[model samples]
Target: MAMTPKELLNQLMQTEGAMCAALVDYNSGMLLESVGSGMDLELAAAGNTEVVRAKMKTMKSLGMQGTIEDILITLTHQYHIIRPVEKHDGLFIYYVLDRSRANLAMARRKVLEAESQTAI
Candidate 1:
């Protein structure tokens, strides 16, 4: 059975190094739902909306024909993830992790698994 968006996010936060996570609507820059906390999810959602749009636009301009699995932004202290929900158009998951605490490969897989279980 599929999990609710909240349940999925909750599961995601249980992964090692999870700092925060949110389900955001890229078009409106709104948080459909959110879980955990370290930074301002509202602000992050709005800012990331632009990031998603810019990536999509760039992909189109470049004639890229594939779907975006996820965008990873690595910082000195943190890792940011932007993953589009395959089942929900115009929506994406925003996730954060503490670099020093996270296992990148495992955390990334956790995000993918969480998205797979999410029911929107």
Candidate 2:
């Protein structure tokens, strides 16, 4: 069975040191569902939409021939991940982790797992 949006977000939050997780609509740059909160997830998710668009635009201009797997933004004290959902078009997963406690490799794998199970 496929996971619901809320279940997907919850699964994301289970990652060690996870701060926030949200299902973002790529076209509208809006959060469809979210869980956990130390920061403003809605704002961050929307901004990451711009990041995805810029990368897509660059890819098109350069004639690149691959889909974006994930975008990682490392901050001074935080790690942000933007993962485009492969099962559905026009959707992405926005996940935040604490740099001091989260394992990047595991987080990446977890996001991929969550993406695979996400239903909407």
Candidate 3:
């Protein structure tokens, strides 16, 4: 069975050193659901929506011909990932991780898997 939005958040939380996870609608910058250990996901969701929007706008202006897979923002001690879902078209997943303990490569792979199996 496909995972629910909440289940997707739960799975992201299971990633090593995961700090937070949220299902966001980039078009509206809204958080559909979330789970985690640090920060207010609602604010993060809203802020990241701008991030996605900016990139999309840039892509359009540049005449880029492909879809965005994800965006990674690396901080001194954390990694923030924004993954847009192909199946859902306009939805995205925001995953925050503690840099010291998270396996970024693995977390990214897992996020992709979860996105593929998630249901709207």
Model 1 CA lDDT for position 111: 84
Preferred candidate (lDDT higher): 2 or 3:
3
| RMSD (CA, Å), each prediction | 0.7, 0.8, 0.7
Tens digits of per-residue lDDT for model 1 on 8-120? 89898998999999999998999889988888999999999999999999999999998889999999999999999998999999999999999989988998988988786
Per-candidate Cα lDDT values, in order, are 0.93, 0.91, 0.92
For candidate 2, report its TM-score.
0.97
Runs of candidate 2 exceeding 4 Å displacement: none
Error of 1 at 51 (Å): 0.6
Clashes of 2: 0
Q: After superposition, how far is residue 34 of candidate 1 from its true place, in Å?
A: 0.9
For each candidate in turn, the TM-score is 0.97, 0.97, 0.97
lDDT (10s digit) by residue, model 2, range 59-117: 99999999999999999999999999998888999899999999999999999988897
Per-model tally of clashing residue pairs: 0, 0, 0
Cα lDDT tens digits, model 3, 1-120, are: 899999988988888899889999988888899887689888999999999999999999999999999999999999999999999877899999999999999999999999999989
Give the Cα-based TM-score of candidate 3 against the true structure. 0.97
